[model samples]
Each structure stands twice: as structure tokens, then as C-alpha cells.
Target: MRTIIIQKRRQAVFIGVLCVALIGIASPASAAIHIYTIEVDAALSRMEVVARFAAPANAISARSRDAGRFLLDARDCDNGDQISNRGRRLTISGNGIRCLSYAVDLRSAAQADQRNDLLHASNFLVTPTVWMWRPRLGGDDEIRVQFRLPNDVQVSVPWRPIKTTDNAYLLNASPQSGSAIAIFGHFDSSVANIAGTDLRIELLRVAEDIDAAPIVDWIQETAYNITLAYGRFPNPAARIVVFPIGNTPWPSDSPVLFGRVVRDGGETVELLIDSQQPMQSFYEDWTATHELSHMMLPYLRAEQRWIGEGFAQYYQNVLLARAGRYTENYAWQKLYDGLERGRESVPGLSPNAAASGDERNSRMKIYWSGAALALMADVELRQRSHGKESLDTVLDQFQRCCLPSQRTWSGAELFTTFDSFLELPLFMNLYRQYADAAGFPNVRPLLGQLGVAVDDGEVRLRSDTELAEIRAALTAQRYTGGPGK
Candidate 1:
């Protein structure tokens, strides 16, 4: 990480720094606060932005990965010097400049992809990567963006809301797992406070006019499901984006066509729903719960995706069973079926290699190897500690200590961190044993001991086994506190 040298200058100090309206008075953290005032036209086709920095910066950039395509114009507000972007970074001809202005073609940016075509005419979707341009942020530095729009026009961003004011957001530097979206125009969005966290949910207006209540309630319920793992959602103020589509360009008739958790400026759960499907199906789908499960862990590297995906895959069923959405037998059967597919996936590929995209043919292995390890660890913790500790408790402590992490971590780092919260080391040992092994993390024996039996090809729960108590407890609801409790 390069240390950001807030380019020192004596001349620009007088222009700003005393009265940042959003920030009362510039403290050390706010001394170099980047301020952006964006004005959107009535038609919402374009954006005109004027930006001011507390001090000179060596260079300013739009953190979005593909900012160049949608940017119409940018110039140094101080000297009228034309500024250009070479990729994501803005190219300034001379020394660091404190003031600069830029413009974004919102409509064109939304039209760049087919997904936005289904969105209502009144509003459009634009990933912040192209629109927001500012100085690169380091630790403690912040950006205050105030949006000025025509009447009835609103802005939704994956950033902390400035409760004291309207249409303003405070953007902080984040690990940024992926690009976050910003919507401009009319939309139905709300905030649900669940388990000590605020989930800012935005249901994009599609042409179908689906009832927002059922969808919004389902999102809130799914997010609440994430809390069953540890009594809280991972990020304090994560965002959820729901776009309803009848026939998506992508293939899938499932209630949830696709879902993902992106940790850009902040964490956001993006779900593409086939709103044409009955609303009841939404409650039964696993994709949203799976995506929300991802919030429990920080973004891991690409190679370690098996751990991230695998853990989410494992928890999705466990949490659902705990929520009573799935019976214990159904959850176990699903886990059994998933593990069988993983075992049958490329036999020679290590979990690490499969996840790193080497074969790309081992999707099941990439998604379930970590789950096998999770189950083993959970059973071992329960058996050894006599019910005192389990995977859930360790994860709960982890969330209290280091969630909403500011940077990415490796599988070893995550496992080791989990071990740190325990009396005896467990995670790293499991990581070393199976992460790079050519074969899967064999949990069939453990499963058998846990009273999960395979009769022919089907899974049957045996309540007579010694470890049946442990198996039952694994999917039992641990938290009695409700959403706001």
C-alpha cells in the first residue's frame, strides 16, 4: 500500500478547511476531506460535478474501474486547464491541484449494459466506478459527496448516510471487493435495522411494478437469517440492491437468477430476481441467504475463494434449517448432495487450484471443500469442548473483533485469525491438511459418526449414533433474540 502524501501547499489553505458544511470543523481525520457537489439534470441523463479538496493532492482519480468510458469532461476548476483520464486516474498536467471539476454521462453509462434496459425509465443504474472522481483515500481520510438533484430525484449510494442532512453521503476507504452501484432517479428504497446493524435496501424499479413490500420484507428476512450465525449482520451499514427481471439476458428461471456480495466502498448484496415468479418462491430461494452469508467473512483473495464460497455454501443451509425454512433432514440432505458433487468434481485438482480458476471445471470442489472442513471443525469443537464452543461461537467472536475488515485476507490469515479467538489452534491445521491437497477434505467418516448414513445414494439421519446429539445441535437455532432484540 503506497502511503498517500497529501501534497503540502500553503496557498490553498485559505480557500477551504474552516467550514466544511457536512463536517462541522476539519479535524485531523477531516483535514483533507474531499468534497463533491453533484448536480443532476431533470431528465437524469447527465451529471455536472464541482469538487473541492482541503489540500492539494498529487493526483485525483475516480475509484471506479471503468470510469473513462462514461466521463464526458473534466478540467481543473482553478486554472481552467483541461484534465483527462488515462484509465481510472485523472491526468493533471502540472502540480497537485486542490480544485477540479468533472461530468458523467449517466444515461450512456447505464445503457452500456443490457441489464439497465429493464429498469424503469425514471431511474437508471450506474456503478460508482465511473461517476465519482476524487483524491485517493488512505487510512482515516474521507470524502463527502453532496448530491443536488431536481425535485423528486434521489440518489442511492453504497456509503454511510449523513443523517443530519439530505442527499449527502460520507465515503470512506474500504477493501473494495467489487464495484458498488449508485442509482439516480425515482426508486423504492428503505432501511431495516436488524440485529444492531442497518441494511440499506434499494429495490430498483422494473417495468413489471412488483409489490415492493413482499420483496423488501424478504430481503429483510434474508438479512436477518445471516444474524442467526452470530446474532448480527457482519457489516454495520451494508447495502442491498434488488433488480426484478422477467427474462434476464443471463440464463436461469430460478427465483433468484443471480446474487453476489461486493465489498467495494462498503458491502452490498446484489440480487437479480425473476419477479415474474410467485413471491412465495422468493422466501424459499437459497441464493440471497448464500450471498448474505458472505458478509460474515472479510473478502479473501481469489485463490482462497474456496474458503469464502465454501463457508457461505455451508452456512446457507445451516442457517436456513435454524430459521425453520428447511427441515433438519432437508438441510443435511442438501449438504450431503453438495459434498457428493464436490467429491466427484475433478479428482486431481486441489481445492486451492480449483478455486484459483486453474481448471474452472471444478466448480463443486471450489464451492464445497471449505464446507467439508467447516463441518469437521464444527464437530471437533463441539466434541472436544463438550458443547462449550463451536464454529458459530468462534465466528461470533470474530465478528466482534474484526468484521467489516478494511483489507483482504488470505485463507491462512482468516483461519489463523479464527484460531486466535480459541484456546487451542484448529483452523490452520485444517487449512494445511486439505487446502492444497489433490483430493477433497474427506468428511464421509465424520458424517457417518455424526449419524448421517448413506443408504444406497440417499442420506438418512440415524438418531441412535453417539454423535447424533452433536449433529442435531449443529442446525439447532442458537440465538433466541429476534430482529431488534
Candidate 2:
């Protein structure tokens, strides 16, 4: 049997009279039944949901413990729905058995709000949020319900269903392994060309050809790679649902690669792609890969976005390079280019610090420059440990320390995690100089030891001798860590 925990928090009482009048439903009766389901029809741009409940005898009331007015809209309710007024029972029922059901339609623009509210509610914050009702048998009186997505929308990935004895089911979108309401996607080869784990192309205009086969292969490969590079997470049974939605337009405020992490009954990571772009372009696929990496490093908060975005950005390039899409030199060159651009723009600022207030100012030095710093650190570690240890090992260790239930970390914790792996104080100094500081350090000079040369607006290898050594170190067949790590 599968067990799910739902925490309840007190909030302002919902006024049912106003809700019933807005939705135009009758008063609810005691015999009314409650049901919950989600519909994602192509004809409907937004997700439409119906929540049904029976009305009480004297009064009808339909109330949500955590769902907010902004996120949820009540299309209809009954007189059975009543709100508490001044700590006294307020009866708003119309007399007969009321069959009240709430119809909530989700707008595409509201995706971010839905994600934030759902995550916060599931984490016990009790702001307005969405949830699937699960029924218990003869124990606690709880509503049971089933959720449905379009079966015609194919999912290529493989996942095992979570065992449950409850009469109701709680469906959620997540990528963690062994989750109760895990969702997966499959590809339709007739509509899109599949290249290993990457989709060669997909056309959003044609819904008939929407396939997830290519993405499934890619996710499986990525999961395998992560497991091979690092051990399984502490929660081995956690299942992550993979939703391969058609590439959508990039949000004006954020890059196309950005996605949201939702903590509900199950963990969810939504990968939004830009289908209009060329499939082979790095920008097209990097977003999916980068967001998926968050599943392993979700403990990062706004303060530690450097570790989150920087590491993901760095690894995205590294993975693409290892896949033979780009040469190692090209990847390094891209990092150098981003570093130069970041340095020229701002001296000391967190890239995402201003994301909450000013979107433009949020573009700080950390993501690109910090990634460059990580690359340099990786090079140094490989050199010091003679390829016996790598950044992947350090990251895996760090995830174990900070991710899971902790869900947040500081710069000091990051440094301490790295120090534990390398047993060195340099990690502390590096954190202070780059991660915790407000200015750029002489990172290019430090990279000089690896035969990299940084001149005015250019980064290049000092000599072919140095290039060959670095190449050998990176490409050595017998290297301890795998290629992408």
C-alpha cells in the first residue's frame, strides 16, 4: 500500500455565499458526492478540472483549505456551501440534496503561479494551491478520486506504478523514481525523428505528430549516466514524472531553458522547450538537460542559485560536448566568452539576485563566471588527484548533504561539502573569493596553469604542447570518471 501525507494549515475562512453566486450552483445536500479530475484536451489550451461534493442538510458549503482565489476559480457551487461568519455557523443551503462541483480552468500564462502556489501549499505553507483528493477506506473520512490525462498523448518512457490500497488516487507530475502519481511520456516516431535521446525535430502546429519517444530515450540515458557517475539518492523509491510538453515560447522574463520545481504529493520538474528553434542547436536541448539536473540538486535556494544555475549551465555544455555535438575546445571557448561578457557588465553581483525585483538587473556575473570558476576547479582537482577524483563525485556528495528534505543550502555549506571531499582549505578560499563575494577574482590567471592563456578579450591555449596535455587528460580512455562527469 502507498502512503501519502497531507499537512493542513489554518487560513482565512472562504466565503461560500460569494462563491456560490459566482459559480451559479444550487445549495448542497448531505448526500452529495465529491469527485476530482483533470482534463488536458488539445481543444482546450488550459487544464480544466471538476471538483464535486455533496451538500450538508441544513447548509451547503464548498471550501478549499489551501487553494487561493487567484489560482482557483469556482464555476459552480451549491447552497450547501457556507462560510464561517464571526466564529458562528453560517448556513447558506437552499434545502434539497446539493450536488456541487467546482470547475477550475488553468491559463497558460498562469503556469508559474500554479507552480509556485502548488509547491508552497504542498510544502505546508497553506497559500491557495491545488491538490488531488485521495480516499481512505473505513479509517478516516476522506474523499477518493482518480485523475486522467489524455492517453492518446503518448509517453515513451518506462515507469512502474506505485502500489496503493486507498480507494482514491493522487496524480502529480514528477520525475523522481517510484512516486505514487508518476507520469511519463512516449514518442511518436511517425511525427518526429528520434536521434538517440534527442529529438531531431518537432512541429507544434501539428498536434497529431506530437511524440515523446526521443525524449524518453534521452531521459533514460541521463538517469543511467547520473546513476553510473554517482550513487542513487537516499530515497531510492522516489519516482519523478517526466512531462514532454511541446516546446513553447520562451517566457519574456526568463530564458527558454528555465523550468519550475514543484513539491506536491510527488516531485515534479516541468521541461518547456522552444520547438521553433533548430533541433540540433545547443540552445534548443540545453534547457531540458539543465532543468533535469535540478532533480539531483534541488536543495539550492535563491541565495545559492550560483550552485544551481552555474552547475547546470556548466554541465549542460559538458554533456553536449561529450555527445560529440561540440568539441572540448568549443565548450571551453563558450565558457570563456560568457565569462568575458559577464565581467564587462558587472563587477560583483549575483546573477539571479534581482530576479525578485528587477528582471534585467538579475542578469549578474555568477552563472557564467561561476561556471567558468567551476571548470577551473574541476581542472585543478583532476590535476591534483591525478584523475582519481572529479567534480561529479564532489557534486554527488554535496547533493546527499543538502538536497532531499533540506531543500536549501548556504555558501558555507557548499564550501564545507567540497572541502569534505577534497580535504583542503582552498575550497573555502574559493567560496569566499567567488561565491560569497561581490567582485571578480583573477580566475583567468589561475587557469594559466592548465596552459590556458587569457589576453584582452580572448582565451586560448598557450601552446600545442599544453593543449595536447589537457586534451589527453580530458580524453583519456582509462580515466576514472566517465566522459560527461
Candidate 3:
């Protein structure tokens, strides 16, 4: 009966189209061609979006939560059809409509400060979710967005750049961990080359004066640090957004206040920094290094966040040491302290449970359990292959096969995939022993075997232990090019 109904509906639609064609009426054009002309005002706080659809669209929407509130007006550009604004989505239903235009007040939707810091200077930082509203397209289809910016106003976005013009980009589906930031204001922008990756860096405008060269150098150094894992950086094109929070009253003496890796439309490393801090302080801070380390793996599921965070935490210390920012002893000491914190955060909870449980107090456990396992895996791989196979080699293989992925990955799946890169299975064994059944993967025994002795929280490195060579090799600068690494 359902098949018969579908057939009748199809026949009626075909007959209607045939009658329209016989009467010299043409069918609507295909919906694959979408062009968005985004106009930014001279003040850089308002955006007018004119989305031209090839055919009438049934649904059009913005992507961010509460983004609909900023829509000042929405109407069909051709026949003035009514458009509905419901939360983050906009709905349009009309015949033979080709254009939809909307105006958004970017100042209201822009984030004044990042990471809960209220004292920073008021600057415009609007993500793409706040301003871009268009018809949804298929996975294979892409939208061409052209920005018409006023003079003295610059824009920064994470979309792929189109070569013919400076302000046009191609937008496609992405694994949106968070909103990809779009900066439209007076800000410093430049490109830095790391291996073959051309990293676009945007430094937000602030009251305090900042030296751009040193910050670029610091970013370059961090990128080089990540290349120690593999010969090249993970993504060919990534973005870095720097928000200055130094003028604000913050207690930390460190240069970087906070950093996070947001894999939205593209991979973006957002760094909140103290611009007043000296150049050396920027290089000394591990926030950028840790954030960049996250790019080595695809975005994991929320329940499997331990693996992502742990891998980053482990790599931060090791990579910083390789970059010569941290002494070998200091790196080991930090790792030991971190693993100890993980072990004590929730005594009975497993890594998976800790990640899924209340994050208020179990944050340490969620961050470090995977780090402990990473250390075990690295040490075991190095021991088995006699310096040929380490965590770096396994990750190299993983990156070559699957990276810049568009989907979320479970921890079990990630580990099983990693296990496929080796002669013997190693990652799943570690996951099985610790992921759900452990307080923490007991790394104390492994530490002792690696000759990382901690006396009163001070790491003492010894050369005579069984796995001492592997410990040194993990932090040693193997890929030496570009900067300190």
C-alpha cells in the first residue's frame, strides 16, 4: 500500500510537470548553486547577507544557539515572501523565489571576551554562526561566499579561500566542535609557514600595544614542536586566533591565559594571551603547545574526551621538552604530578566514567587517565621495536590514513584503529585494562622501569634503567628544522 501511494504521488507530480511544460512553463532551477554576498559595514559591527538561491528553498538557517535574535530583518528578495525566524533556524516557503536577504547586528552577537574573562577590552569578535544564514545544501555541494568589506576593515574566517578573489571562500560541511570564529574589525593578520602548512594567524585589536613578530615566532615554534611527532604538520591550512587579555586584571603571570582547539569548519587554535608579557614568556607558556597538540587526533566524542585531552597533555610536556622550553627533568616531573592528580581525582572511577561523570571535580581524572595510558603505550612500543616503533610512528600512520576527519570518533574506535598500525595489538589492551575498569592505569611501575624517579615530586632521571633510552628518545628533538625543534 505504501509503495502504491508513492507511485501515485510520483505519477501525479510527473503529469503536473508535463502539463506545465506543454503550457510553456519552465521548472524551477536546481538548488545546487548558492551564492552569499555578505556586506560588512565600515564600523564592522553590522552584516547584510544576501543569499541567492538557484531554486526556491524550503529551509534556511543560521547555526549558532541564540543567533536568531540578531536577525533584524528577513525577507525574500524577489516577491517579499515572509521568512520565519525560530531560534537558530529560518524557514522560507514560496514559489519561484530566488533571493533571501537578512540583516544582523553583529555587536549584540559578538563575544566580548573569551574564557569568562570580563576585563578585556571591548572588541568585535563575531563567529560565522551569528551572521551567515543560508539554504542548506547536500554534502557534495558548496556555497560560494563573497565578502564586501568596507575600507580599513579586514575579515578573518576559517573557510577555504577561493583563488580568483581576496574576499571569496568556499563553505562546506565540517565537524563543528564549536563555532568557527569570524573576525571583522581592525586586527593584525599574517601567515606563518610550518613544514608545508600555511597557518593563518589573526591577532585581535586591543588597547595595549603588542609586538606581532614575537607572537608569530612563538606560534611558529609551537607548530614546529608538533612536527616532532610526524615530519609535517597535520592540516595544510589551519587558523590561529589570538585575543589579548593582558590589560584585564588577571592574576596569572603567564603570557597565555587560556587556549583551546576548536575544530569547527576548520581547525582553529584560539589563544587568549597577555600581550604585555615579554616575548620569552609567550614561548615559555605551554598553552599554545598543548592546544596545537590536539590537531594530531580527530575530534573525539564527548564521552571519550579523555583520550583527546590526555594525548594533548602528554604531548605538551614531551613537545615542550623537545622544543627546549622544559628541561627533561621538569617535563617528567610535570607528567608525574599530572598522572598523580588523575589517580586521585576520583579514586574508584574509570577513565571513561570520569569523562562522562560530573566534570566539576573529576576534571583531573578526565584529563590525565589517557595520558597515563599514552605513556604506557609509548614505552611498550619503543621496547618492543627497539627504538623503531614509538607512539610517534603509530600516530604518523594514523594521520596519513585518517586526519582532518569530518566525524567524531569514539575512544574504542580510535584505539582499535591505532592498534591496526602495529605488528601486534597494543592500544586496545591498554584501553581494556584502564578505560572502564581502573582508577588509573598504574603508571608508577612503568615510570620506575623508565628510570623516571620522583623523590618528593622532583623528577630524577637515571640512565641505567631498562627503558631509559625510550624516555630520552620521547623528549629528544628528532626532527630538527625551523626554530628550536
Candidate 4:
């Protein structure tokens, strides 16, 4: 059985935070705190938003939907207000209305391509962009969003959960990695301890009786695989939202549908699972491991997305091998095949061009170009420092310096930062050669030197190669955590 920790907060503190009303004090308006109280209906079909600003606001606006699609209907203004119903943003102008109230249709807000399920009266999902509206905030400003729900209702969000209050969270400006999901209603939620991090996981309600134990156990193991990169997991507090999508109903029999890491409010790994599949199959799924590996670095911009995706691709296989999921030879085989695919992708297209242009046509290039660079850097670091340095140590240092970063980073900036961590600058040099240069990185010669031989399309490992030691050190397990613990 999976462990479930029911969190409790003092009612007094909760009421105190909610009771922070408009004091009408003669204080600096910017210095006052803004409060947003959200009341979820008993049926969980809709929600009422009441935003109370600390002082009179110059203007209030709703987050615009993508492609000029309007999702919010603003009505019932308290004070003499001017409402501008632009398809994207909802601008409200009023001097008398201190608090704004609006009704949000939950079903309409929950409609998203990834959400693939019909909105039920008891269960639905949404992101903050759907209904949240507030005054513009400066650098030093913050907003408090509190949720009021019925006894059976619960809320799961990517924001930092407030320990002192019930159903409340704190939100700040962040680089969104797609819209972070917020589940409102009943679900199977649990907290697992993995490498000193408390990962809160919520499995949404499904028709089938989804066994929480094996699912959670798989999650714990996958997260532990990421710890092989460093001594601990990347983020101390991250959320994992699991949605059961039933069995594959095909020949693959893969236990996971898909998984993605969203860094909007906070770090969240959303996974789609096949509930009917056997528990043992999930241990072999790489989606969760790949998604979790993305947290090793901060969110990068779209043009530099290869850096994030490539690092993730490289780490997933390496970490899985270290975790005993794959033998050392099998791991090398997978890596060799992946690098070959990347090399064979659309010729004469630089990684940046492939990424910023039609990525679907150049998916392999975008995904593996970075992996090739990672492998090259790892080998170089290992050889230069005589086994004292590697990508693992560099990433560990990076975690110590900057991680769970709130802003977006470019490839150049990230490479420069990596170079700073090393005694000999290395990352930018690789970037210069491969990022904008046509053709994939030529790592075949380096692989041959590392003793990875492909005979009749079958990878054969040899021990007499010059860089065999470095290759061994690349995927060697550094952590003592055993499998199936």
C-alpha cells in the first residue's frame, strides 16, 4: 500500500490570512499585500474568484488565452467599472471597486488538448491562466491565492503550498513550461521521500481501481534514478501529477503514455500512465526518468531547447544504466543508435536551425545533438581531470549554485555558466562548433576511440581501447541506493 500523509493547518492562521481585507490605510500602495480568494463550488463544476488588492489599482487584467482565444467571462462588477472584452486580455478599469468578483466556468477552463478527458461534475483540471486576474506586480511584490473548497474537495497546484494555511499557495512570476495543471476535486494523492526530497504525487480518479502502491513505487524508483546524477534529487519540493490513461491496447504494452516537466509556478512532472498494465512494466518505462532528468537544469528558451532536451536524453539512459535497469552494454547500444539517428537527421541543418524551425522534421537532430555534446564534454572532462571531473560533478556544482531557476536562459548563457564551473572552459567551445554549424557533431571517431565497436550493426564492447576507462566512468553508479528498495 502507498503511504498517504494528510496535511493539516491551524484554522486560526487560515482565517487570519483570509481575513486580511482592505484596511483603507494611508500607506504606500505598492507596499501593501494583494489577496485572491477563490471559492470552489460544492459540486466542483465552477469557481468564484474574488481578488482584493491591498490598495486601489490602476488597472486589473486577466491572462490572455493563446491565439486570441477568450476563456474567461467577467461579470458582476461591484464598483463603477469599465470592462474591455478583448479576446485575449480582460481589462477592468474602476476606481470604486476595491474587490473584483467573477464566475469562472470550470468545464470551459478545463478544455485543453492534453486533458483528453471529458469534464465530469466531480473532477476537472485547469491552469492559473484560465481565471486568475490581478493588478500588475513589481519585482518586490507578491500575490497570495487561497482556495475555499467543500469538505470532500481538494486542490492540486504547482505553486508553493503554504504550510501555515489551509488550501492556500503563493504565486510569483515564472517562465512557464507549458500551462501547469491544477486538479480540483477528489484524487489519490501521496508524498514519497526520494533522495531527501518530498515529491507530492496526485493520481486523478479513473474508472478502474488503480493500484497506488506499484505506481508510487515506480515513481520513487524513477526519481531515485535521477539522484544518480548527483547526491540528491534536483528540486527539494516538486509536484508529480499522474493521470491514468488505461492500457496501451496495442502491442507495445508500455506502462506509460507520456510524461512532461512543467516549470510554470514550480517544478511539476505530469505523467500519463496505463493503469491496467502490470506493475513490473513501469519499471522499464523511460518517460518518467526522462521528464525528471529535465530538472537538472533550469528552463531554457525555445531556440535553445536542444540543450534541455538533449541533456535529458543523455542522462535518462546513463542514469537508468546506473540504476541497473539496463546492462552497461545495452546502455551503450541505445546511446550508439540514438547518436546515429541524430547524425542521420536532415543534413546541413544546424542544431539551432533545426530547433527554431520545423522541429517535427528535425526531431532527432534537436533531441540528440545535445546528447552528442554531453557525451563529448563528459569524456573530455574525465580525460582532462584524470577521472577527478565529469559531467556528474559539473552538474552537481551547478545544482549547488543555480537550479529551479525562475527565469529563462539561452544556450549561450547556459554554456558560459557551465564553462565557468570548470578550470578549463569547455562548453562554449563545443557550442561554437555544433550549435549553429551545419551537420551533426562527428562523434563517431571519439566512440571508436572509446572501444564502442559496431560489427554487423551489433555493438561490441572492447577493453583494449584508449578511452575505455572514461566510458566506464561515464555511466558508473555513484550512489549506493539499490533497486526495488
Tell me the TM-score of each prediction against the true structure. 0.91, 0.56, 0.86, 0.87
What are the runs in model 4 whose C-alpha is more than 4 Å off?
Answer: 1-33, 54-56, 64-84, 94-98, 111-121, 136-141, 247-253, 482-485
Off by over 4 Å in 2: 1-128, 132-206, 218-266, 276-278, 282-284, 348-359, 362-364, 400-402, 454-485
Model 1 scores a TM of 0.91
Tens-place lDDT digits, model 4, residues 192-250: 77867777888877653556777877888888889888778888778998887664555
| Per-residue alpha-carbon lDDT of candidate 3 for residues 374-417, written as tens digits (9 for 90 to 100) | 89999889898998999989999998998877678998899999
- Model 4, residue 153: distance off in Å is 1.3
Cα lDDT, all candidates: 0.83, 0.43, 0.78, 0.77
Residue 246 CA displacement from its true place in model 4, Å: 1.4
Model 4 local distance difference test score: 0.77
Give candidate 1's error at residue 326 in angstroms.
0.6
User: How well is each residue in 71-186 modelled by candidate 1, as lDDT tens digits?
Assistant: 99887777767888899888875568888777888888888856677787877888888788878787667778777789988789988777767887777788877788888888
Q: Which model scores highest in TM-score?
A: 1
Q: Quote the lDDT for 56 in model 3.
A: 76
Ranking by TM-score: 1, 4, 3, 2
Error of 2 at 475 (Å): 6.7
How many backbone clashes are present in model 1? 2
